[model samples]
Target: MTPLLVGVLGVFGLFALMIFRTPVAFAMMIVGYFGLWILEGSRAASAVVLTESYSAVSNYSLIVVPMFILLGNISSAAGFSRGLYDAAFAWVGRFRGGLASASVLGCAVFSAVSGSSVATAVTIGKVALPEMKRLGYGDSLSTGAIAAGGTLGFLIPPSTGFVLYAILTEESVGRLFMAGILPGLLLMTLFISTIVLISYIDPKAGPRGDYVPLSQRFKVLGRAAPLLAIIALSIGGIYAGVFTPVEASAIGAGLVVLLAFGTRAINFAGFRGAVLETLKTSAMLYMVVIGANILNPFLAVTHIPETLGNALVGWGLGAYGTLLVIILAYVVLGMFLDGLSMLVVTIPIVFPVIQQLGFDPIWFGVVAVIVIEMGMITPPVGLNVFVVKGVAQDVPMATVFKGVLPFLLAMIVGLLLIIIFPPIATFIPDTMFG
Candidate 1:
């Protein structure tokens, strides 16, 4: 059989494995190893598997993954997320829909430290959800805000999504981090605005929260100061050229650990748990990275990306038109696949097409992340929506999904703005590095 046909069958088999409850990493590895064996030989397949696994695990740059994960886990154990929520609430909770808006802001702030959408949603939801419920905020608006806000974890600096994208595409991790800042803040603003609009249409849906006094606001800010400092030091160090992305991760993780210990927020038992959780999460990520690396070569040998890129080019859609088609495909695929799965599966195929169209890789990285973030809240498989549901178990699934729609629309608008003016994603990296 032709290599292209083999590649097609391999993809089908991969999906089949996924449907049968196979882990994505192992499924990709299984398909890739055997596909390579069929095309080449057992010797080459074994060699590829060994080399790729070792290389993927040993790559120094990958250290950023665990460090950042550890930072987030440590922060959660320390209860820093509560401080972030309190600080945001102190400032914004008095206005109409203020509690929901503060949830968004809190998610955005916590995302800077946590770098995982589920963590952001779950952490902020625990704090903000109860408060919103007490204030008579509708379940839809409260759950929607938290779910939508959690997506910032994928777009903000220290993002695991960006790290994976950089690993897959061989782009600069620091540049990708820089590129996400403006777009992250932009999306946060849009989410907050959506909450405002919702409350404006029906004030009862989001009753005004009690105003916080200046003394209390400052006190809350003081409580959150440590986390804010960590964000500035880690992300800011990258911008100032004081640390590489890996170094920044190390610094951030170390500082969080120290803070947790110094404040006695976590004892030895909690610290041990954080380390164990970090190892588990890091190992999972490493598996996916190794699997994608293995699968990439098989796809390359089969010339699938080349064939797909040429086919798209032949469709006679101009650059922008083809780009739109690609974006639409992501929107559809997102309904079923999680963001990382969609990203790892498609980038190998679509990135070549993106390069052929002359779009900047850094800018595309930012745009692609935003698209993936949208998937985290999209229906049928919105990961963040499910995460928020787990936190707000009393809220119906449909209500949570309903809550995310306006925020999703707001994200679409932000995506459009990024497309129309690429600098929205590119300006920071250019200004800083160039």
Candidate 2:
């Protein structure tokens, strides 16, 4: 029938396929290609698909994706997570709920290299969960803290999510990376504060257990020097304009390799494993990118996003009300869908509405990320929770979900803070890239 109706049906059908366990990339590509062919003759639609795929994939800016992915893969294999946790533990393990706080800091540090939330959750869980449980931390707090902290992987600098968002929205990659720094640190602080508050309320949740002596703590600090150096150099260098995003990723990757090699942590097996995993992950991501390109034009043809935006803007709701509605929608959608899929499916509609309301895209990116982070911890389909659960099969799923509640509250606060004060997301990018 009508083009708009066809677009509507296409989106629903694609989601239905995804619900039935079809791979997201394949589902979108298949629907998009056929829809375009139906809308335009087969030859013309096929040509459009080929051209979009090439242009999207061949852009030099996209090299950052693989380089950053390789950086994360290499660092993970090299045992950076252990060093990161140990360092944070050395400094904080003596404080109240110290182990839990260390988990947050460790996730933040590890995220600098790993950049993938699931990887952060899984890696840090392996390193932090055992110690937290051994130290008599409650099951809910221990599991929940790690699960919530892992999401910082996507918010912090060198984030894979940010990279993908930038590519899709045509925002500056470097600026988007810079935009993440403050919000990431602020959210990490919120998580830490949540742990302290919880522990304070019920000391039983996290027993002080024992305090390491200052002299011994210094020794623990020495063990973490490698991680500190890598984080400062990579993130700091990028901010200082010392390197492009791709170059910074490359440098980060190289440094991690050398450090891992020097420490004897990364051997032949680890090196090979890192490379292979990187290739596979990179390939999978590119495939998704290719699929999005195929599907996006078809969605545009439908004009549903435009129609929806106009309706929202036409409503008497002020900008703040509109934003609140969007965040609520994200939280609800997050319960059932993964963050990347949500982004691809919704940004076409959301971005235009947001821009029409006089908000900056970079600021909106930060806001969108925070909303998605909430989804990562929420029920029914929280990716980070499942990741932690997979590693912590002994812990009940409900306990893990319950523990992350405070952090989820904290994420909501973080989102509000950014919304009320846009500079929280824009200050760094404005100062550095303006």
Candidate 3:
């Protein structure tokens, strides 16, 4: 068969494996290895697998993955997420929809330390959902806010999504982290605004929270100070040029561990559990990286990206039009695939087209993550929605999906603003590094 035909078949086979409950990393690896064997000789394919596996594991930059995961796991085990929620509630829980807004703010703050969207959703949901329910908040607003806010984990600094994007595209990790800051904050604001608009339309959906005294607000802020300091030191150090992305991860993880021990928040068993979880998460990410590396060469051999890029350019759509098509594809695919799976499978094919269109890679990284965030709350396979559903067990699945709709619309608006003003994602990186 022709190389293009082989590439097409390989894509189909990969999806089939996913459907059969094969892990994404292994599925990509199996398809990629066989595809390479067919295109080249057995010897070349064997060498590719061996070398790619070694390089993926040995690459020093990949250390960021496990370290950041450790930081998040440790923080979660130490109950820092509760502190973040309390602080946000103290500050924003007095207005209409204030509890919902506090949930969004808490998720955004916790996301700075915990880079996983599912974890952020689960952690914040367990804390905020109960409070909202007890305070007479509607399920739609409460669950919707938590699910939508959880996506911030991927867009904010220290994001695992950004790290994976950087690894796949060979972009600067530090620059990508910096690029996400403004956009992350923008999305958070949009989420909060969505809650406000919803509550305005139906005040009973989200009643005003009891007023918190200044003394209590400051006290809660003090409780959350350690987490705030860790975020500042790690992400702030990157912006100030005091640490590389890898170094920042190390510092962040180390500090969180120390804080956990000093505060007696985590015992030895809890610490060990955190380490084990980090290892498992990191190993899974490494396998996906290896699979992507092996598949990249096969895709290149078929000239599929070039062919597609040329075809799109030949169709006479302007850059923005082509981009719209790509974004729409992501929204559709997101209904079937999780964010990381979508990223690993599609970037090898779509990134070439993006580069050909003269778009900034850093900006695209932020934009692509925002699109993935939408998938996390979208129907059929919305990961964050389900996570929130698990927390709010009495709330129907449809209700959670309905709750996330406004936030999804808010995300789309935030995405459009970024697309229209690319500098919103690029200015910090340019000013800091240029």
In terms of lDDT, the best-performing candidate is 3
lDDT of 3 by residue, 294-342 (tens): 8888888888888889988998999999999999999999998999999
Candidate 1 global TM-score:
0.99
Model 3 misplacement above 4 A: none
Two-way lDDT contest, 1 vs 3, winner: 3
**Candidate 1: regions farther than 4 A off:** none
Model 3 / residue 306 / CA error / Å:
0.9
Candidate 1 whole-model C-alpha lDDT, 0 to 1: 0.92
TM agreement with the true structure for every prediction: 0.99, 0.97, 0.99
Model 3 root-mean-square deviation = 0.8
Q: Which ten-residue region of model 2 has the weakest summed lDDT?
A: 206-215
Model 3 misses residue 310 by how many Å? 1.1
lDDT of 2 at 398: 92
Give the per-residue lDDT digits (tens) of candidate 1, residues 291-407.
998999899988988998898889999899899999999999898888888888888888998999999999999988899999999989999999999999999999999989999
